[model samples]
Target: MDKHAQKIAADLLHLRGQVLSKGDPVALPLVSSSMFHLPGDPEGAAAYGRVDNPTWDALEHSLSVLEDAPCVAFPSGMAAISAALFATLKAGQTLLIPSDGYYVTRLLSDRFLSQFGVRVVQRPILGFADGGFDGIDVAFIESPSNPGLDLCDIHAIATAVRKAGGTTIVDNTTMTPFGQRPLDLGVDMVVASDTKAPGGHSDLLMGHVATRNTALRDAVLDWRKMSGAIPAPHAAWLLHRGLETLDVRFDRMCQSAAIIAPALADHPAITAIRYPGLATDPAHALAKRQMSRFGFLIGLTLDTKDRAEAFITGCRYLRPATSFGGLHSSAERRARWGDDVAGGFVRLSVGCEPVDQLLADLMTSLDRLMSK
Candidate 1:
């Protein structure tokens, strides 16, 4: 592992839940109470679950440590995204978003935020760095953008946005904090869907927004409280547990992807392939400079939707699922979700399967598709 990854692994291993006394539980306690008892003064204590919870405090502390900034937890990724947008943007301000990023984000900006009189501009991932930030009040970026796997220079974009008196927020969901840290690169805020890699298991829905600016952090926190976007205590606890194993799980997934990306690149069945880990990938240089590790997602295209479906069905290990960053490997055709990709475009999320076994399974599936 690289030095950064090694350091993250060490830090994650030493993370411990908040300990109030000598006999406090070593594991993170799941305090599921909706309202805390306040016999005395409730001024400084948590009065209601909607405002705050001890479980969330512990989880957010751990997340803040990982992100190197303060964090606020949310019920889901969209909730976190919404909090960031609503907290920072005003009705007349302009918001810049990736045209090819997570489809839901675009939908939220176009269908919902637009109604609020927020002028939204859509730019492809490659255009972010060179695309002037003039008149933009906020910029939302996703490096190594979803499905397409394109990368942008986060530091450059952040610097430009800041110079223009704008806030920069990055969706670090694809590359979890273990793999990338946007705050260190000068981003104003970092939002992520913990449901992906950080949760590791596909069992819970959770997300968080992290930032070093206290005012921005409090703004997002207020949004969560007012909108009732807080995550359940049990889900928060599960996510905290999931963090313990994230370093190892992410390492294995990246390692497997490094092998799988190259092996599949030259296949006759694949018309195009995009994995930043591959030396031939267009975004490889930028990915190496800005990201600590190449992510697990691989974008590839076949000739037709039937060929893509056949490959997914023929594989023994890869399941057909929309979500990525789980224990089991999975894939999905992006066009089905209106991602503006070809009908045969596939987004493959590498999992923790044995490398050799996983590669063989992928090759077999491709070979079968070629045969048919």
Candidate 2:
């Protein structure tokens, strides 16, 4: 809450107005040219599409200011993470990943990075809560983790990892730069999928890595250049537009989830609830200490996969969608995606909908399930 402490709205407003010079469009101008004409020097910031773009630079600048670090944007969150891992680790190194975190990351580690000679170990997020980084070369954390919304002590783990001469990477997709700054918490690299709440709308796909270390930033940049995984100019611009209303969008969505998660938890059909925002939640205390907001996503488990499906299908207002953090509330059965959670597990992405209507939809849906 330093720079972002004050309303990030102002900075976003500045980005919209300043992306183009005086008498320019109020919105960030799209630089669509595949190649920019360089002077006789043959050296410039952006010579080709794979290299750079004005839209990307402006968006990165806005994101970096939030983290107070250097930032690199990529085509997707996975791309940014992939680049970060490839740029930092070499063959035959050890990597510690969260078993409760993003499954795709685990897939990349076990199915891809491992093939290249890296040792991949899947551990409970807090397996090293005490700074136990023995023989670990790299560690990744996703605070208020996905699907389950589990929280991890980032600062403690990062400190331990650094002491052990290992690198620390944090996926801040849930909390975002507004909700939390992982780099300030001692993490070496902060990665995010702007496709989620940051995009606000359900339309764009993008990601980025923010870091305080110049070497780490350059390495990630180099990997992105060589791999040719870059965000679309329009998508980047759309994301930046989404950023303008980020403070408002995130706050509204989180407010609704805060109300909705608790009521859903108390239902007889629900086996468990996992929203860090709730005081009754196990991660509430730690989240209060570490995160600016509890987050907009909620996790719940029904007695069976059938019941879970019934609940979602019965809802009047909530849409059944795979993604989270959109303008409309939606949910997906996590197990459908092959997550390790219970077959009845549901990941609800609360949106900027009227809270009363949302709560009623979920409650009524659950009531129908119980009756059946």
Candidate 3:
């Protein structure tokens, strides 16, 4: 089998040589012990739970295949992001972040980074290449940026950043590794809140960072160890369960978005829509070149925040959720979270469901929104 298929099999069956039993269980048996008997050879595999575990190893290997490099798993998405930040940036360095990404990311930069002596600056994702990377120590790019669905030119921007003695970190959560590979574009690191698509069931919280650069990979690994930001073996197994269906699930979700986005765009109650799958979207041309599949996330604007809330509340198929990439559709009023977006803006996560039923549910909700 090809590498991706092999990785998927590894995720699904967890078939490995280490399972010495006559017939290994299909799932990874979580190792719950905090410490293992190291004896005199502490250098072997299966170290303390904080540093290594078999469950994490299987999933990390699969992710490493997806990213074409080493992978480090974390307890939460922010933990992985924090590891990247703390690993690369020193007190005096400047961090250039996407102004349109997840709200908490902005919070981390503005509220958290400043206290450590690092300077934080915000820039929109669409024109990131022209943002001028000189004197910038780190640049964080979130293509198909959260809530905005804006795309960035990773190659051009990463090239500029490197020439200026800066590093580029791409948040690949929206697209997932199957959708885009930033390492191929010269990014120094790829990080994601695997809690979203990677943990598609929404029952687990996990994150990971992947890098082709050995030094950066080793640094992030060390940071994760020192910070104790490791995922529980059981949580890692749950992430593995969700990831087994990632390729199929992501495709269905993207397909759903392809239909839903244009339909929303045409609705009278909708003021605007941002989805790269639509040819008229500002990010379409660039996304077509950069992404393997247009992402599952959709952004639409209504007349008001109340109307947006009503629309989500009115939907039967789409759940009112702050998260994304599950089996059921969901949406949230992003501005309520203090994101610097339009008060009427909503971030919709397309889920895997029958196309007609999903489309009808959303359109009907909008009709109800208009009636009210």
Candidate 4:
């Protein structure tokens, strides 16, 4: 790695104590086709800001190294997914998505793409033994899906899709590239919401797409130009900076999450604990095969929606909010988003906080909920 790459990597690895000094200013790099050329020389100044920016270039380059695939940063994770889908699928083509897909992707397919002669099919995400993917033009799979926390057999499904002459896309948002690298495991492309782990501080929002195929990269670039969904240079820089410490932050959070998941599994006030690390998790073996870390997100279904609400109100440490994979712990009632996720289900985004402190807060919250 070059000096620049090494600097970024070092920052990421030692995030625990590193702080931006007063003299260090985080500025957005100027958008220039060629920084060496005069600004008045339009031809030499490089392409339009839409195509490239130094900050974004730094992020893209860093991410490319980390993922070991060509990386493209976008305004949001959904935008990366949209751009990839738009670039790959066309009118009169069919796209197969998991039946229980991410709520946003499901909404985008059902509401927006249908009018463009695009057909979105919902394939069952049942285990490999079930042969869930029978026919599909492109298969989109999310292992350990949102809210439901179900796992998909990515390797098996990807093998089936390739044998049938179909494309495969994996949403690696929950696992991030730190926990899993789908491209190495035979998937064509991997998408992530960098707003989570990659931007560990939770102050920025961005997304990324990495693929080994050159043709697909070109297609996504074309779609990105047309859609005007490129992220601002500043956001890209933040993502790049945050990625430096991603492994450390996730390591801490995963350790905490592993402890919390099984501890809550048989809690008297808890109905069920959804975490892939658990031996009882439906996708345990598959997750163990695909992911290095079990991840920091955890789901708990309380006895009832009312009790769920009570638990939400009772929690003192975990903030009642949405979004996960941040420096601070956050909790959310899934039904608040109309997810059909059990009313009492509370999703937890475990952070780098002391695990014992978090556990105490959780136990107290459950006890309070039971009292009510």
Candidate 5:
């Protein structure tokens, strides 16, 4: 097997290596590079709170295995992405981005980085055969993109962009490292909101960037050191705890999402549904080829915006909120989030709840919306 495939196998087998003590799992790794007294430890290394932390390093290592790429962790998803972007580009450089990328990422490119004379163009990223991605230094992509759940042809885009001497960075937040390994598909960098599935509880917010290129990896590490975007030790520890059960949690969540996505697709009140796993989705073929799992988020658009709001509000159990990959199934109108997502669109985050309960709740909520 190739090195990437070996890494994938090793990562999938990581849970088997957990040191079991008296039948209870240990919370921390057995080996740590902490402590200043070690003979080989670097001198004058007490470089403030942001440079390095043992807890964060462990999480980064664990996540690197999962992602099959060397990684760096940050306080939030945007921090990780921002550091990566800064490392890759400079003043007057241009990056081509999916028009439907995560809102905060678009904000960073348009609202913040624009001040530095860096330009971001939102190209049509849903399909392949490259019409919109011409002449860009970098391509920022999101498969099952935020709110829209639109899957781009990662390998296609990666191949075309690489031929043109452009780099590719994919936001792998929605699919998690377990479900989708972007690096294996030839992307230059993979960024995940460790705050989501990596943290799993919605209580902590963090981000990680995984990459194979040593120079880019070192650049991101240096950017993090300079920008002070490092994550808290405790938060890193919490994310590590979540990583152990990632395979288990995501398996259940994806199963539930598969059940609900089709039901929502066939519903009379729903006009559009975007789930790459669904056979009818435009990106289904690309998604099936690139991703191991279809993931848990589904974007469904109702006939009207009012109906979308009604369904979210009327759900007896589904919470109306931002953020996803938590333990409780939640639904929110994507357009309300200040993104360019269509107004009638609803984004559903499937949780670890029973598939039947989520489906029943969804059906009831749709009925309620139809009544309105």
Candidate 6:
């Protein structure tokens, strides 16, 4: 087995309560109390739940190992994003974000960050590596950007931003830390919506920011504590449970996507398809160089919104939903969410379903739509 896989297994298995205990619990014990009892000295012990929790510590430690840095957890992906932004940017500083990445990030910058006197700049993901970062204080990258599935050269972009004396952050939501580690690729910080793939199930919401910089990590932790954006102990426990099976689950999802994307590309109903796993995809070369796995997201376009809806409706396995990185296959038409894409474009999040079944379901849906 690979060393990383072995490390992950050991970390997760050891999360079971007290390795030195004579009889350790089969699972990590949930400490739900909001306050820890102070006998004499409260100096070293947890004082408040909002500021700290054992469950959160376990999850953060596991994530820190994977992310190769110290990490801070938050209630949701947006909270993490907001924390990273607030911790990094100051008034009159310039922030650069991917134009085609997750919409809410842009919304946050425009509606709120701009009011604080921060200059916001938008750039497409395709050629971002070569883009000029003059006067940019921070560059927010989203390679294999959400909805579009576009790729950017992380090392190149980070190198440029660093040369210009700016911080670089990558949203690694689509490709979990297992798939890609931006820090290893020269990025200063890595933020992700653990609510997506890391959570594995659609039931919980969480996010985290990981960085080698101790100061930044401390700032993020302070923001979470002061803003009360900390995740629930239960949610953190659930995420830790999800992380235990993430290796197997993520492998199956990627393998299924490898099979399904090609099959979808060949279908007459698909006008265009974008998946870094595909050799024909424009981003394949960079993805191969940077990512260990090609991930499970596929961007495909049908003829129109009606056809896309019909295709989704005809599929038995694909659930029409907004979120991705769940156990169940889900898809959504991006244009409906005001994305700058064709009305027919669909962002498909492949799941752990058997490849043959998933392929058959997708092809059957396309065939029926064509016949109609």
Give one digit per residue, the lDDT tens place, for model 6 in 1-372.
Answer: 257856765676565544557776777777788988879888998998888699999888878766778998888999999999999999999999988999999999999999999999998898675559889999999998988999989998999899999999999999987788899899989899998888888999999999999888888888888889989999999988888888788888998999899999999999999999999999999999999899999999999999999998889999999999999999999999999999999999999888898889999999998887
Which window of ten consecutive residues has the lowest lDDT sum in model 2? Answer: 1-10
> lDDT tens string, model 1, 152-178?
999999999999999999999999987
Off by over 4 Å in 5: 1-25, 29-41, 44-48, 127-129, 132-134
C-alpha lDDT (0 to 100) for residue 199 of candidate 2:
93
> Candidate 2: how many backbone clashes?
0
Q: lDDT tens string, model 4, 1-372?
A: 235434545654543234446665454344434244436656744466786576777778778877878988899999988987887788887888766657888888888887798888875566432644455667888877876778876777788888888788898988777677788789998888999888988888899889999999888888887888989777777787788778778879999999988888878998888899999987788888878778999989887888877776776778777788898888888777777677888888899889999898888888876676
TM-score of 2: 0.96
Please say which candidate is ahead in TM-score: 4 or 6: 6
Return whichever of 2 and 6 wins on lDDT: 6
Which residue pairs come into collision in candidate 6? none
Which segments of model 3 are wrong by more than 4 Å? 1-22
Cα distance off (Å), candidate 2, residue 144: 1.3
Provide the lowest-lDDT 10-residue window in model 5: 29-38
lDDT of 2 at 141: 88
Per-candidate RMSD vs. true structure? 1.4, 1.7, 2.3, 4.6, 3.6, 1.4
lDDT of 1: 0.91
Instruction: Tell me the deviation in Å of residue 22 in model 4.
Output: 21
**Model 3: per-residue Cα lDDT over 287-342, one tens digit each:** 87888788888988998989998899988898898898888889999888888789
Backbone clash count for every predicted candidate, in the order shown: 0, 0, 0, 4, 0, 0
Better of 1 and 5 by TM-score: 1
- The C-alpha local distance difference test score for the whole of candidate 3 amounts to 0.85
Tell me the whole-model lDDT of each prediction, alpha carbons only: 0.91, 0.86, 0.85, 0.79, 0.81, 0.90
TM-score of each: 0.97, 0.96, 0.94, 0.88, 0.89, 0.97
